[model samples]
Target: MSANKKNFQVPYTGVTKIQVGKKLGTSRLYIQTPSETYKFKFQFIKLEQVESSIRSFLPSSVLIESGQLD
Candidate 1:
């Protein structure tokens, strides 16, 4: 739900936008912050479940965009 590595963390509050959709026949997740945009490819994983998890962790102020994957 959150991104963490060693001593670095990207808090949910820092997230400005989230986008879920298919690109080039691949399911992708895009998270945007003030200065960065992270892209993740969903392979063999359920995107809806992932989205739900992310939604649960994110603030209501964050914008989430959902697109049809089919």
Candidate 2:
């Protein structure tokens, strides 16, 4: 059998907004840039740590928010 692989990368510099929210039993992080929006789902407990780590590398101009997921 043969398999194909792909690598996906997103740079932080173009980040325009970051939003962390909880839905069901998991936490979700949404990252928005000029061209696309990326979504990540993780354990609810790690939300803060993930947010802080992402914030450290991003500029203050980037808007970060926390709220319930729609």
| Candidate lDDT (C-alpha), each | 0.76, 0.78
Best by TM-score: 2
lDDT of 1 by residue, 20-41 (tens): 8876656778888899888778
Q: Which window of ten consecutive residues has the lowest lDDT sum in model 1?
A: 1-10
The total number of steric clashes, by the backbone 3 Å criterion, in model 2 comes to: 0
Off by over 4 Å in 2: 1-14
Model 2, 5-33: lDDT tens digits are 44445666777778988888687888888
The CA root-mean-square deviation of candidate 1, after full C-alpha superposition on the true structure, stands at: 4.3
lDDT of 2 at 44: 44
**TM-score attained by model 2:** 0.66
